[model samples]
Target: MTSDPDTLWRRCAHLGRVLLPLVDQEPGRKADRHENLRTWGIDTVVGERLMEIFAALAAHAVVIDSSVPTAQFDALPVRTVAEAATSKRDFELLAGLPDSFADVRDEQAVQLFRLSAYEGGQASRRLFQLSREVRHSLIVLAEHPLLPCPTCADVLRRATEANLPK
Candidate 1:
């Protein structure tokens, strides 16, 4: 099937790629803005937010790219994090984060950014591979041909289930 221009997987890939360079000296961001975060620095909770975002995005990429029709049936695609509804609450957990950054002192904001950058780097370095492996099992389980993969349905399910709003 011809992919829609605005699928969640596509949005995730686009956003991830944009944020990818923040974790490194890369192409996405302009040098100075990137420098702004780099010049500020120590890191994980914040790094972890982007990590959850990226992880969900990655899982979406896999299942969608896997071309498994059954898997695709379970995916949810919405424009903004506010509208996103999934079993994994990671995206929504950080729902207010961006606004929080806007209100906080630059120092605090940078710290949050730094932590996010650190986790993003960790994810890139594969330091988080073991957890991904654990998640992989859920994806496998969801492949039963009848039911949807809740894991893929909500990539951040395990990571943020605890933090989900009551």
Candidate 2:
């Protein structure tokens, strides 16, 4: 979508919900968790889990009135969301998001996703890359449009309590 600063939040939030989990899991597991288990990119376990979530969202979004986009959604490359142009626009909008309504405009969560896959320039992604479960919990505080609320860190823990594995 061509982002407008006023309505840019929806795009940023949508991207945050969609991409943060993937970016966080781009590396199979965190270095702290398994210092020895250093997989550079997605592995079977992470890939399968992501596919499961993607499939579930695609299949069941219609069941409830949700924003999972059963019909009107982009078929563009995943990298499109991380494009420098869009990311720059989204990044600027975050500061103007109605921060008073923390429930709606969570700047941190959006930035966690937007900066994680920064393109065309060097951006520091240290904070978003959490080293511990507690820190990860902070990122998941806001419920995402595409994914359910209170998400746990894929690097540290998976939500076993959920009905389906994510």
Candidate 3:
């Protein structure tokens, strides 16, 4: 059965909701409560988690609804979602940060919602990578002729709770 753009978008949001908590794990007994993720490549746990989320989205995109062609979606060029990108102001409100939205956006607010696997590059490189994935997927959803279905907007609602400061 072919699913429409709206349904596909909802599925992506659901996938994001499922993987959101993994991005923010509780500390181990000895580890600091607020630990930083190392810059280790996809071999590490952090990297693996990010890849897992992407993989989940890919699998769901093709199988959840037949409207999206696997090859086409996979080939979408990832890039920043400038106009449709999640606003920095929303990030600040959700994270309850004292700093200005611009400060957080400049620092890496995008990375909070989407995890990146790329290794070292220029500053804020990972943010750019995450934005690429987001933008690419959004394009797929917007361009594809999707079918209508019940949505999982609740997943997005729940994700707001996990929003934390960088």
The best candidate in terms of TM-score: 1
Minimal lDDT window, size 10, model 1: 77-86
Q: After superposition, how far is residue 161 of candidate 3 from its true place, in Å?
A: 25
| Regions of model 2 farther than 4 Å from truth | 1-11, 23-29, 32-73, 85-166
Residue 159 in candidate 1, Cα distance off native in Å: 12
Off by over 4 Å in 3: 1-94, 97-123, 147-166
* Top candidate, metric lDDT: 1
Evaluated at residue 108, the lDDT of candidate 1 is 54
For candidate 3, the lDDT comes to 0.33
lDDT (CA) per prediction: 0.34, 0.30, 0.33
User: How close is every model to the real structure, measured as TM-score?
Assistant: 0.30, 0.27, 0.28
Q: Which residue runs of candidate 1 sit more than 4 Å off their true CA positions?
A: 10-42, 68-166
Model 1, 1-166: lDDT tens digits are 3244235444343333222222222243234333433433313334334333444344443444445443352353222221231233322223222222222333253344344435665433332332232233233333434444333334333223334321
Give the RMSD in angstroms, all C-alphas superposed, for model 1.
14.8
Candidate 3 local lDDT, residue 11? 42
Flag the better candidate by TM-score, 2 or 3: 3
lDDT of candidate 3 over 28-124, digit per residue (tens): 5113211222432222344334422342344333333344433233322212122223232222212322233233322242253332323334423
lDDT, model 3, position 68: 42
- Give per-residue CA lDDT, model 2, range 1-55, as digits (tens): 2223333333333333433343344354334323321232434443333322222
